[model samples]
Target chain A: MLSAEEWDILRLSLQVSMVAVLAVAPLAFACAWGLARGRHPLWVLLDGLVHLPLVLPPVVMGWLLLLAFGAQGPVGGWLAEHGISLMFRWTGAALASAVMALPLMVRAMRLSIEAVDPKLEAAARTLGAGPWQTFASISLPLAMPGVLAGMVLGFARSLGEFGATITFVSNIPGETQTLPLAIYAALQVPGQEQVVTRLALLSVALSLLALVASEVLNRRMGRSHVRD
Target chain B: MFEIDVTLRRGERTIALQCASAGGVVALCGRSGAGKTSVLDMVAGLVTPDEGRIVAAGHVLFDSAGGINLAPEQRRCGYVFQDKRLFPHKSVEANLLYGWRLIAPEQRWITPQEVYDLLGLAPLLHRRPVNLSGGEAQRVAIGRALLAGARFLLLDEPLSALDAPRRAEIMGLIERIRDSLGLPMLYVSHQRDEVERLAALVVEMD
Candidate 1:
């Protein structure tokens, strides 16, 4: 019952959220690890900075991104010299989504990682595991369920991201107009209630799917150890 | 061989210990909170001593004045913790081989099969750490340590958490390991009879 334009919106939204979650997962995990384990006073600052997106107005986050990643901005200028740019592009939309999702992902992952017994890491060390090895073999696997949950939360947040994305990338149909932006655009017109309803329903469906998928993965992760 | 002269400062307490041994099982006998586990931690390089010299397995594991302190991974010390810190996510077989597989072939002195046989761990191999009984978990913990190509062993009250029968079983296994492998061990325990039965030299710590 959806038009080709609506189909394009759905596809673009999925692509943006997927890219955002994948790109943010590793860096978010690192931030989570630092917040969980680092004792240095500087970690307090890092923790605040990482969670800044969660507390700040999304429009403000979008504005900050625009300043730092706009073509005239320093990083953007350097990237432009390298034949790359994120200004008003779908990649820019993904960047906005990623920034908005980071804090939620980090918070969930951090709690999981902190819950991991430090004694186990010490044991790994005595068994000849270096810090990196201990993290990979022990810490990461133990924290997998929460990490997965974080990713799902990030994906959901990215899918729903609107204010930052619209501010950073603008509503360019077929380029940067994702599901939320599309719904917002539809809401601006009279007799577009049909379009808004369909889009909103699709958003809820996608979120539910993500939650169910995470729950299934979580159960499987927990069962993997008790295979006997 | 082990030679340790270390001073550590805990909150509101200072622990000073000096001990030397020509190998075999050198037991550190002390009551709870007497810094026995801390001493083991220092030797394993898990904790740094405020000031000390530690020589283990012919290596200067730590020397404060000489400015030498090995990392835990480099110490080649098989530390069996009292809680039996097996990776709960891994099978017993995987836990046993976790360190064994990391060592270079040339550095490895024992085989996984031998560790399994010595500890009677073959049957428990497929089980996870959560499924193992107290004694069985301790055995797997010991086997895991032994398979890591340890230059020496550090056991911190490995028997304290088990029931009487399980404790006796593990005691027998410890004796077997001591006699057969002849690896140097820094065994920590507060029980006098256990120390007397297993230790070649008893160093009392307060």
Candidate 2:
């Protein structure tokens, strides 16, 4: 028998994760494109910074986020003044997840973009496409497989984001307790073992599902690029 | 109308090109890396030369002396790459319509239906580039450039990537594009046959 609280946590987790993924998509695409195409010294530094969160301890990342966006720090201070809050909220969890997923997204997109022929881009230009038009039309779509893979991987990463989310947003039940946080909360209590197990199972299942979907999508995209 | 006289000093390799034109295909014949495409790059505002004056259709496209270089999209010339660089995300229809969107709507002299007819692209209109064949892709590419309101056309080894039969097919498509569009053209090819088949004027590179 599932408790109402457990179900509420589960539902909230899904909502927050999906919103997080949706919000991060555009940012990820831009970062990936810059890393793949933009040629400036600063681009390299920024690329490294985006990938930094992937290497840093999630707890440390959360601490940094807490400082910068905690309704008191610069970003957070500005957000609070603007009547938007992220600290210890579900949105904060999403941001944390987004930061964690950024590197993977950038990596996948870069690979796909690199695989494309530079000559093709030159061709697009000669066809009278402005730079932005060329990017929107040629670069983005051809990098679709990578984009899809990036999204799936990001979603999966966000689904299990534990330390950074917990540290940055805190595990406020119903408001910010994502699946991993909820599971962590459940595990701390003696009688909530069953709930923890269920959520854990759900996480594994979702990750597997995402991987399968990416494989299928990539294969299909490959085929379309090949034959009748 | 296009005219170019340029000397590109690349580290040590000097790419030299000389040609001038008003309204006909100017064939640039040379071995690979003989600076044929490099010349087109300068005329289309893709590359800046060390010393050059380039004029296209009475416009100052590029001139090292004047320090003037127009951007590619602003030049209004059509360029067909060897690989047929169609937008992968768009349908054949959308890719063809891309350049069409850039020009003033009223200034457009080419129609999608006409392009479809010219390239035999009707059956493939809804399809993405990933589904196109070698010959079909090149034809669509040619049609796309023509419909994009190009006053000048550049074909850079337009048939180099295909098999002999596919190459022959694409060559004919190139001819059709040139004949129908009536735009001034600069065609780059090493194959003398290709030069003879499509060019009305020849500029041989050493």
Candidate 3:
């Protein structure tokens, strides 16, 4: 019962969010680890910078991304030489969404890491584990629930992100137009109330699905960690 | 043998300690925060002092004058936290094996079977940390360190979290490990009874 454009928006939403989560997962883990455990003077400064996107206007964020990653921008120009174009493309949408979702991901991971006792790490080190091995074998597995919760929360947030993605990548149908943009376009067309209604229902369903998935995954992970 | 000489100035209280252990349990005895944990932390390379020298079995883990400050892992000091600090997600067996994976086969001393026998972990091998009792968890913590190829074990209030009966059970196990392996240990606790029962030598702190 859905039109091709509607399907295109749904597919694009999935693609954009998946790419965003995958690309930033390792980086997010590193950032969260540094924030939770680092004891240097600049730790607070780094923490503040990581959370900047959460407080800034999404539109403003999109604009900054455009200025920095657009073809004319210095980094973008350098990247273009390597054939990596993130402007007005799917990658651009992912970048904007990842930037928007970073704060939420970091928050979830930080709490989990802080909850882990330092003594345990000392125990591992005594057993001859290097820092990286300790993290990989001990900390990461223990923090799986929080990491799952963060990734799901970020996916849900990206499904609703309007300002940043729109500003950074613009609303190009079948290219960057996600669920929110599609709904916006439907509302602008007069006598097209039916399309608007359909899109709204779809958005609610998608968001609800993400939320439900998160709860399920977190619960399952929590069960495994607690027993052992 | 392990030898440490250091002075720690915490606020106004300046605590200086000098001690050496040679393959026997040495207890750091005092009430809470009697510099008991600080001493062990320094020896384990967890904390740095203004000026100090820690030589454990000929390896200088920390020497302020020599510009040598080895990390906890490099120092080969096995630490057992108060709460056990088991990897919550892994099974008891996996948690035990976590440190083993990082160790070369030649360096690994404690076998899984030895751990299983030491703490009766065979029954709870597949269980998670949440499923473990207080006594069982501490026993796992002990086994985990042993399996990781620890040259020296640093136990910080290892049995304080348990009830009376559970503490007794774990203490018997500790005695057995001490008698069998003769491994050097720095036992930290405020309980005078625990210190007297387990340690061969006692260092009283203010």
Candidate 4:
């Protein structure tokens, strides 16, 4: 039984995680494709950059984002001039979560894209399909199972995002205080053990639900891959 | 029609080739690894030759000297590989129509109904490639290429993957396509009988 304030925290966390996953999915897909198929030296450089967040401490990632996207920072200052600001905002929380989720998403997607037979793409090309059309019709559909798995992993990562979100956007009730932050806040207060337990359970339930749903979706897509 | 003079460097071996054809079934007969498939790839724009000129159906697909190289999609060549290479995810109908919808209506010489009947594809439309037999899958692959408005076709040992009965059946189908459809083909096969039975002109390779 979550209290009204607790419910607000849950809702905000969902909103932020959902926004993060949506915002980052298409970008992550492009990055994955580049890494999987690109033969240029720059692609190797991009591979390292994409994996940086996965290896670096989340706090360092947060600090870098702050330096680049904070109000006084270069991109942030230009954005502020246009009446848009991400510092200390819920959107900033989403950006933090998205950055944290990227490497996991891209890694999953790239493996699947690489597994696609290039000969099939060649066949499509001879059948009057252009590069983009071939990717959409053949490569993308063949990679759906892995792409869905990546989204699930990304969503779970975004939902649990803490260090980066806390650093980029300070915990503010109903704004940036997601599940982990709310639990931390409750733990700091005396006699608030029950509140912490409830929030923690909710987080576990959400992650479990994502895992089960992704399993079901993957089975359906896997039928096509049974022979291959 | 095809006129090709190409040179390719493959590891230590250098493949130098020259051929001219007025079109129909021009069989490229060679032993395994003789670069028969590589020639088809060059014409399809999948593999670039070191220096070459390829003219197919009166269109110059590649001419290194003139800097004229068209992309695979622009060449309008139907390529049926040894493996058939049917899209695993799509149903037979979808796979059949995948390229058909890309061609403009006025340029579309073959209709879906005609292809379905020609290839006996109607019965397999609802099934995916994974469920299809080798012969059925090969038929769908050919139907797909035809529906794409291909000006010419390249068949790379198209019957090499089938059993004896299936081979005979598909060979018959190929004869019908050649005699009825009147489409020009650059057919590749190592089998002497297949070449003798299907090709009007046979070019030997080492």
Model 3, TM vs. native: 0.89
The list of candidate 3 runs beyond 4 A from truth reads A40-48, A216-228, B21-23, B163-165
* Ten-residue stretch with the least lDDT total in model 1 chain A: A219-228
| Model 3 C-alpha lDDT per residue in residues B31-132, reported as the tens digit of each score | 786788888878877778778888876688888899999988777677787767787766788888877777788978778898798789999899888789
- Comparing 3 with 4 on TM-score, the higher-scoring candidate is 4
The lDDT ranking, best first, is 1, 4, 3, 2
- The CA lDDT at A166 in model 2 is 88
TM-score of chain B of each: 0.97, 0.92, 0.93, 0.97
Better of 2 and 4 by DockQ: 4
A1-228, model 1: which lDDT tens digit per residue? 889989999999999999999999999999999999899999999999998999899999999998888888888888999999898799999999999999999998887788688989999998999999999999899899889988998999999999999999899999999999999999999999999999999999999998887677667555643421
Residue B183 shift from truth in candidate 4, angstroms: 1.2
Give me the candidate number with maximum TM-score: 4
**Residue B188 lDDT in model 3?**
86
Per-residue alpha-carbon lDDT of model 2 for A1-228, expressed as tens digits?
557887787788778778877888888888888888799889989888989988999999999999999877999999998899998788899899888888887787677777665666676777677888777777777778878888887888888899999889888998899888888888899998788888888889888998888777667556534422
RMSD of 3: 2.8
lDDT of 4 at A199: 95
Error of model 4, residue B71, in angstroms: 1.1
Worst 10 residues of 1 chain B by lDDT: B191-200
Highest lDDT: give the candidate number: 1
Q: Could you give the DockQ of candidate 2?
A: 0.50
Residue range A89-113, candidate 4, lDDT tens digits = 8999999999999999999889778
What is the DockQ for all candidates, taken in turn?
0.58, 0.50, 0.60, 0.73
Better of 1 and 4 by TM-score: 4
